[model samples]
Target: MTTTKPNMHAVAINPATWPRQTYFYYFTKIAPSGFSLTVNMDITATLAWTKAHHVKFNAVYLYLVSRLLTTHPEMRIGYLNDQLVTFDVLHPSYTILHANRTMANLWTTYDTDFETFYQHYLADQAEFSALPGPMPKTPQTPNLVNIGCLPGVHFSSYTPLPFKPLDSFFPIFQAGQFKKDADKTIMPLSITVNHATIDGDHLSRFFNELQSCWEQPTQYLA
Candidate 1:
């Protein structure tokens, strides 16, 4: 689990000219709101690719979601040091079930290159996967999207209620077990986001692009 911390910085946005400033204010100050949406994403191609490559499906899911989140600037918007800012890149802080039934929180710095990120993910698991505690193996960062998978349960919907205050705007993702729907494999993915930053359009585009990636895993996963 020994790795150098990447040079992370949060760049402030100028509200005067920022297009979403008014929406941000209204959502955060006037009536703070957030929503969650769950969709059954087709993962037939993705599952086959993972099996053929002998790769973990969870890793592929995390990489694809994190990659897509980076593409949408709204998903990366969060407060840093009490100042509104957007991060250069967002990392995936995910849960790893331990042998003793407890879970460990581990994170890997995201990279545009899938192989590099996959190696980092494997290394983190190697070092911390056996730990029986919820404490994070690596230091926590502001630029993170909370991610988890429940491989045993295939549910229709899921909504996450964070114990932390509602001020935090970074998205949270949870993926459920794979379900066979006729000839297609579906995975229920729940995305929880703040309205101050992400809107319905953003979510729609995210899902559309995500489905494309799942449909053509060779293009993105390879």
Candidate 2:
């Protein structure tokens, strides 16, 4: 799969005019730390839709989260060229486990149109899903959020630490195996974010929106 690098550019925010300036300063300077929240999302509707449409759950999962991330400015905050900025869009840089038990890093550029993005994801998987390596299948853009799945485990809590200092502001997403809770299907989703950019209120709003999406899959998944 040959493609040109995305015209990725971060738009710097004026700290004086930004509403989260104090929170960002306190978190990044006085007490630097990140936070993780894990929620059991009801994916029954999403699963049904995917099954009926013969769509891959992973693709839909990624698409839903990416859409939300791009929608929320707090989730898009990152440092670019030493300036705090927000990305226009965030791509999904996800992991694919190979038959040999190794993992390959693959990513697809996100599009507002679901079909276009879904087809890109399918193409990426078709070309590099089996390749076993730590290297990324495609050239990664600066505007990317790390995403992966642990299909074998359904843990109640999860917290991922940042491996790079620069990645501290970017959100990391993980989803666990789907399990049944009564008549509903539950998927454990873990979101790790820098407190400097995201707060509990922001995270709560994100969950609310995500819940709405899962409850009404036809809105976007269709």
Candidate 3:
């Protein structure tokens, strides 16, 4: 007995330009044990590359992720027993920004596959551009509620962990398969995850797959 809900949201507007890049954040209760999970992902080259290429890096990233979701149906997050459960989608807790900026990262979670997710992102992008007022509303899991945002927003800075043996490496955990880039040795990503579904082993796999995505590509290659 599964149910579906239609949630509409407003896009994040640039303080300087009004409507540019937008982001959404949601918190969910992990399934099985229902432990609360928080993870962050660092799209290190996300902004920089997009700006240089004059390509919508955010759009490309979103398209790739959306495609991943479709190829791997089990990766989506859903609702169960008043808790948010995911077979595929891994909902992160904190927003990943560049150099600890006040601005939020432009990432999102979806329930379907890559193609559908990509189309959805495009549709939303058009809506944001057409809207007369600032886009408002954000997605919240389990509850499926809309949240508010502030106007004239700007980003703040964040600091990575200081040099420490434990801080040397971070873990990556995902549902399907992926690879890493060979040219780049250190790929730094901030991941947000649920405590109930994964342990250290799962997180480790995610990083490995993330690297795989950049390295020997399976599907998501630019």
Q: Which candidate number maximizes TM-score?
A: 1
Per-residue CA lDDT of candidate 2, range 98-168, in tens? 78888878888888788888998998888878766786575667787887899999999888754776544
Q: For residues 91-181, write the lDDT of model 3, one tens digit per residue.
A: 2212222233343322234434544444544555443333332222144443121111121222121223334322111122221111233
Model 2, position 136: C-alpha lDDT score: 51
lDDT of 1 at 35: 90
Full-model lDDT for every candidate: 0.86, 0.85, 0.33
Error of 2 at 174 (Å): 0.8
Evaluate model 3: give its lDDT.
0.33
RMSD for all candidates, in order, please. Answer: 1.4, 1.6, 14.9
Per-residue lDDT of model 1, residues 1-222, tens digit only: 466365357789889989999999998889988999999999999999999999988889889998887788899888888888988788888887777778778888788888888898888887777766687475667787788888889988888876877656888899999989999999999998899999999999999999999999999877
Clashing pairs in 2: none
CA shift of 52, model 1, Å: 0.6
Residue 33, model 1: Cα distance from true site in angstroms: 0.9
Q: In angstroms, how far off is 41's CA in candidate 2?
A: 0.5
